[model samples]
Target: MYVAVKGGEQAIARSLELLAEARRGDVAVPALELAQIREQLRLGVARVMQEGSLYDEELAALAIRQAAGDMLEAIFLLRAYRTTLPRFGYSQPLDTTAMRVRRRVSGTFKDIPGGQVLGPTYDYTQRLLDFDARQPAQVACADAPLPANMPRVLDLLDAEALIEPIEPGNDPEPIDLTREPLTFPADRAARLQNLARGDEGFLLGMAYSTQRGYAESHPFAGEIRMGEVDVWVCPEELGFAIEIGSITLTECQMINQFQGGNGVPPQFTRGYGLAMGEGERKAMAMALVDRALRCDELAESNDAPAQNQEFVLSHSDSVEASGFVQHLKLPHYVDFQAELSLLRTLAARHHEDTDDTPLCKHGGARP
Candidate 1:
């Protein structure tokens, strides 16, 4: 086994130089500014912020630029930056009931308190390339006003006692996942936190598995809403909460059938998901995974991949996953050399065993 310690050092440095050159491309073209990424590629920035578990648009934009538009790397950069920040007092839980909703839809009901308002969604758009994006054009707005606050669809079911009622402060205090190591049989809060920061594609695949009969779940998008929700924080001296800021969020509430288990009457159960910014798909997938992981709570079978807490939470973080996968490209001379020597020893033993074995010279079958 050859170790290229000296040559590898020079090669890595040169590779970095080439990467910088490739990232910038020609000198004539203007470099992409942070503002451009923040405004033009706003969705990417939002996803980076959500997955990174940080809410700073400026920092997310800067990370996107620095990562050369690689989303996982941008998320990694944002997470790294967030770890260095001071830990201020924790904010009070956000009130989504008071959200200034921009889009609200319900698959379960056609007519709710607020009519279905499909605002800023690509659900019905034709999958065609826009040739006009090459040239700037003035976009016109149509005036169709919706109410500021729309009632949650699930609330309607709760009124009739058709769904479970979650009293405020009934559950245990949530564990701060970042500060503590994840253990088996995690609580709902820990699982949701991990899923919020989970890779979108991985969750999507896991969620899809349930639909394909990997697990038993029949879900309806009871309600999906996107809006700006106020964040509040209370200082010890103040003794009351004050609005700190407002951030865009997407909330998905999934309704699933609970077939009379755990000494509970047959009724509808809820799986909830909420994500920073307008990430409806991520929220939906998260809701499905959340429901799947709640087998024990529901007294259902936990014989599925999505139901396994260790399997899902352990591999959720994009930052950790990206680091581990990308680290393979780096030097592994010592590790490979050890494996090579082991393989040679095994081969020599196999050859000696073959030489020791007795062989019949006759081609015919033994009597």
Candidate 2:
């Protein structure tokens, strides 16, 4: 039975009110302060900042709280907030080589210069859940002085002719993706920016696919560094670059073996990934997927799902994926009715044609 459905406005209003109430939680209990979230839920804040392409910790934390701890929704919230923000100016390419390294590691070499500093990593921790909500304990401060700066492991490789060298230059201005639509055949910078803001799960899945004989890319994690990098920009009037604050970044560079193809000799190839915060998994996954997407350029077989640029890049953002998938719950009655009418007509026509056909193939007698 078809009934005229109404009250969409009321439903939406109620939904909004419920969302607000849920986000706030019980009024009796103290509301979560932004600082508490930023400090305690650092990982969640980092994820939101990484995926949202915004480095503000406090804002990311607020988004997380508002989204009720939903990471993807938090990312969406941050992105929406980001759209309304005014861009002051572009920052110059960060000098990661001069990064104040907290954690740096290289997988390609057994030993490298500056040595491996596995600083503050959860990689080796047991997965057993801790059932205690212990109070924060203070640790004694170290009296010894810390290192002023640390060099990148990859720079040591560059010293030798083992790894391909990247030259420093004035990076061309980047187009704002929010302000402008993404176009096909994006440049390396553009692609990296897209991948950095992309959904972690989606990128991880694509990376996993490449390893499972999809793109057949033999990738090695050349280096993964997590630290604070200085952001600089040269205003035309200033005529020189100025440091515009620092941001924590996780950068991953994947080394791939490219056999002689596309007129290029057998050489070590590169796949790069950089995130706004400590997002090692996302960065590594992004590097693999980035290389997989470049199969055509390297003249590799492009039969894999990972190698399909359109498919990989298009579905990489959680915001877009979640919205479109959930949007089916919205109004679609017109389309549904059309489909229903077409199916009924097809069924009736098929039955009528069958009924008209004789039961016996030879002459026309009813059984």
Candidate 3:
């Protein structure tokens, strides 16, 4: 009645066939085109691009389709693909102040210069499902052309020295996390890069924990902006920087009031987060967590989960988390057998001790 399972090759082949069929749903219906997904499901594509660490909408859309709409899986696919590609060169530091603003808003102020433009957002829409999405509808385009460049609200504060000024200079370059192993006491750039590709849900949970008296950061979202910024890179031979390309980025600045300690005066501190694509939620969450992790630098009490940099950054990736968790399903008979033997020995010893008669009773019976 009991037979060892065989034909693993056949089983694997069948599973692949089934997966391909499922990914391609109905033969009669045309396949979900990559361009369609990129344009129509732009938000989903954006999420994939943000977490995937690759700013390619078309590839992100394809990964989404291949992964059957699982965002994390799509991210994994994109990351894997990105690893195979050769690195040409590094891009120049983006000028966010000159970003072609699509959507910009500031939570700290009532109104600021370069007035807030809430472009193409679902923020106001009620979360109701529309049953009449049979075909996409076209709306008439606006007659007026948008501005080419928009100044950041922070720059206004920077001019007055109301905000902490970040001096622009060539800081030490960061090590690539993909190529190099992560070490403790990481710099801000490296930490930010890790958090950008981090799992949104995990980071969000950790960020929420801080709000609930964990790290206890009184954070105000100073500003959150989404738009395209030109990436420029200066090759050693070029002698000057040139525009490489433009990338969509979401940047978040968090202001946390820290009564200064550690020989520093009280000042409004800053936490920053920037992502490669339109990822407002992730960027915002990352900013909060980033500030929390900098407790030591800010002289704030480091007593929360988010404040533990090693713990937070190390476990933020879903791909790593998922792989380690699911690896338990693989064969562990040897370890299981070892545990079983130990339990059996303990049980046998217990039984023998319970069954033993008193030595006095045995001597009396003999007498």
Candidate 4:
């Protein structure tokens, strides 16, 4: 193989230089600052952070800049960096009910306890390109401040026992997916963790499949909220939890109709999703796929690709998938040469066998 040749090292070094040159583009253009990416390309940073399984905005922005706007490469960079950091004590589970609401909406209800607060969304705007994006825009202010906390719509259903309750402590103690190997028949905690870090586009397609009858999970957006949620952690010596920090989060709670099965009465089930930053689409897609993966647990028929845990989880990470696919670009000289030799030998043997056979009319080989 060429790798065993003397010039292999020099070739790799030259390739690296070419890659660096290409990544920078024309030197006349100004380089993107980390803050610029963090502020302007926030949704891209959010996706990198979510898929990277890390929450640092600055690092995510840096990764994006380093990858030259390639999202999968940025995710790979961040994930590589994340593995080197030392492990710290885990933070306590977040309480979303206490989230300081910024954007809240419910597809299931037109008017709810908290009137729909549409904060900074593109849904109402025209899809036309803005030629004057660089110009400063006039802004409007609300007459009064929004309430600090709003009740979750799903809780209303839970009040009447119409929906299944999801109490935190009921599940098994969660393990860090990065530190341990994933085992089959994964619990909800592990599955949710996997989906939280899954590729958004992949989950989005899978979710869409469910709506198209691949896995019929008749779903309604019970609530979709985006805001800052306080993070708390407890030290062993303190014996009580204290506020560490707050992080922007988007949460989606999906209400799905479930008929009676496995000795359970007919009721509305739940599919939950949470993502870092304002990732409404990612969160919603995650919720749909999360519900689909729970077919076995919910005693529903597992007949769809989305419902298959092994297939989904194994290919969800963009970093892993990209590496497996992109590795094909690497040197495979030896392997290709062996295949070429085999094909030529087969061709030669076919010609030798047919040469001795008599050709009848119509140029056909006779037995």
Report clashes for each candidate as comma-separated counts: 0, 1, 2, 0
Best by lDDT: 4
Distance from true location, Cα of 234 in model 3, Å: 2.3
Give a tens-digit lDDT track for model 4, residues 188-296.
8899999999999999999999999998599999999999999999998999999989999999999999997777888999998999998999999999999999999
Clash count, candidate 1? 0
RMSD of each: 3.7, 3.8, 4.3, 2.8
Would you estimate the TM-scores of all the predictions?
0.93, 0.89, 0.89, 0.93
On the 0 to 100 scale, the lDDT of residue 201 in model 3 is 90
lDDT of 3 at 220: 80
Candidate 4 residue pairs that clash: none
lDDT of each: 0.88, 0.83, 0.83, 0.92
Off by over 4 Å in 1: 1-7, 142-144, 356-367
Off by over 4 Å in 2: 1-6, 138-146, 170-174, 261-263, 356-367
> What does the lDDT read for residue 119 in candidate 3?
72
Q: For model 3, where is the 10-residue window of minimal lDDT? A: 1-10
Query: Residues 1-367, candidate 1, lDDT per residue (tens digit)?
Result: 1466778778889999998898888989999999989888878988999899999999999998888999998999999888888888888888898898888999999998979888888899897998977887787784766787788899988999888788987878888877888888889999999999899989988889888877779899999999999989999999999988899999999999888766788889888888888899999999999999998888889899988888988998888888899999877889999999999999889979876454467754345
lDDT of 2 by residue, 9-30 (tens): 6678899999899888889999
**What's the distance in Å from true for residue 278, model 4?**
1.2
